[model samples]
Target: MAYYIGTNGLAAFSVINYLHAFMFLAFLGIGSTIQPMISYYYGARKPEMIKSTIRISELTVLSLGALFILIGFFGADFLVSIFGVASDTIADMAATGIHLFFLGYVFMGINFIYMTYYQSIGYIKPSVGITVFRGFILLILMLLILPYFFGINGIWLSLPVAESIVAVVLMVYARKGVMEQGTFERRF
Candidate 1:
């Protein structure tokens, strides 16, 4: 799709993708920190502690998400420039892609948090389901369907759309579990 957009598009996408990789790793770090702590608390039947851990982790992840949005929105040109994007068109496209793509970060962190929470509680099925849908299934669907109508903007939007959908699904599932358990507790 970037190639279809032109060399500038490809170049801009490359820069945005590289930065995205780093941001993804940072999100992974959040998962790594929360997973074990949540697991240990859950194992001990310490529901309060588990809740506290989740609260803290969610706050941290949300902060990071906000930072990503800020950087992507305000610093896109600078970020692209770091990748040696000299062409005005490439810089502009890259900057736009960064701004649009980082919108996903708003909800992406919550998806990660929920996925890690499910995994920590040993609810492997939902964790795997969320992972598969967000990382592959929904993404592929959006990539295939959206671009046909909206063009490159659609392609850029695919991640946010996928993440937002998965987040909503997970939130609904969590709410159902909470309703059954009566205290935001894990069902499994």
Candidate 2:
């Protein structure tokens, strides 16, 4: 699509993707930190501890997500500039893509939190399902489908759409378990 859009689009995408890589790594770090802690608490049969851990992790992740949204929304030009994107066209594309793409961060952390939560609690299938949907299935579908309709803006919108959908599904699936007392057993 970028090739169709020309060199400026490709350059903008490259810069945005590079910055996205850093943001993704931070998301992974949050997941890594919570996974082990959740597993340990669950193993100890400490439901309250697990609840507390999740609360803290969710707060932290949401805060980070908010920060990311702010930066992506307001600091788009600065972010592009850091990569030395001097061309106005390229910079505008990068900044626009950044603004649109980072909307995913608002819900991205929820997907990560639940995916890691399910994995830590020994619910492998749901964990894997969430991971696959977020990382591949929904992403590929949106990447393929969205761009066909909206062109370049659709490409920018894909990740946010996929992430938001998965997050909603995960939340709905986990809702029953969340309200139940005792062990966080699998519902489906």
Candidate 3:
């Protein structure tokens, strides 16, 4: 990616990758928390408990995501400087990347929860599909296609766009499933 996008792109990536370390770990923890609780509730045949757990988990994840976006948007330059990247070009590029890259956090938390939810409920395909599509196929396709069209900004935007697309699809289906209002249906 650095080779394709050049020094500035690499710098941008480096900054986000560093900051992403903690956030990613936290998100993983939050995401992983859903599975056992969900599975237990599902086994107990307690539909209401399942719905409540989903709501609470979604709220927690999305709130954390929003916090990450706020951090990225406000701390971009400071964050870049933390890496000792003094060049204005590199700093600006990294800041832009932070601003854009953080947007993925917005959708990612929800996606993570969905993945675990699907898995806990024995819906193996969607769970694995979510992981593969965002982390692999969609992301790789974006990495290849976006930079060609939107340049470095395209690279920064790829994860967010891919996450958003998957999130939208999952959310729509989820809305019609047990998580939404009305009686719980095994939709999707």
Candidate 4:
């Protein structure tokens, strides 16, 4: 990204990296809060309880995602300003990136919820697939492709775009599970 977009872009991305670390921590905390309860329900074979737990957790995360987007959108200037970049150009770049990059927060919550749900239910494949896809594959693909079209903005969009794609796939898979067997099973 730095290579494609230059030094200023790298500096802006550094701000994003810092911001994303915080987001990751919050997501991890949410996952930690939900995982144990879901795991217990699954172990006890309480499918209804598991369903309820997953549902509530998903909602909680989605709400958090919304909050994150607001922080990134409305607070973009302040958020970037906090970094004390010497150049207005860098600061503006970071602010713009924040607005674009934070769009992923909407989908990221559900992706984590699904990953947690799968892990809790002993379905390792989907969990791993979700992690690998979001963390590596989709990220790389989006970085490689989005830039070809959207230029610098595409670089900013890489994370959210990858996350949104994974979330869609997860939602479709979960919906299929609910429709087919009346509940999500330990499968893809």
Best by lDDT: 4
lDDT tens digits, residue span 1-188, model 3: 67666766676688888888878888789868878998998888887888888889889988999999999999888888888987888889889988998999989988888888878888888888999999999999998899899888898899999999889888898745866553434456
Q: Where does candidate 4 stray beyond 4 Å?
A: 178-184
Q: RMSD, each candidate, Å? A: 2.2, 1.6, 1.9, 1.6
Model 1 segments beyond 4 Å from truth? 175-188
In terms of lDDT, the poorest run of 10 residues in model 1 is 175-184
For model 4, the local distance difference test gives 0.85
lDDT-wise, the better of 1 and 2 is 2
What TM-score goes with each of the models?
Answer: 0.91, 0.92, 0.91, 0.94
Clashes by residue pair, model 4: none
The best candidate by TM-score is 4
Could you give candidate 4's per-residue lDDT for residues 73-124 as a string of tens digits?
Answer: 8999999888888899889989999999998988888888888877877888
lDDT of candidate 2 over 42-73, digit per residue (tens): 88888887778777877887898899989998
- Greater TM-score among 2 and 3 belongs to 2
Q: Each model's number of backbone clashes?
A: 0, 0, 0, 0
Alpha-carbon error at 158 in model 3, in Å?
0.2
Model 1 clash pairs are none
Which is better, 1 or 4, measured by lDDT?
4
N/CA/C clash count, model 1? 0
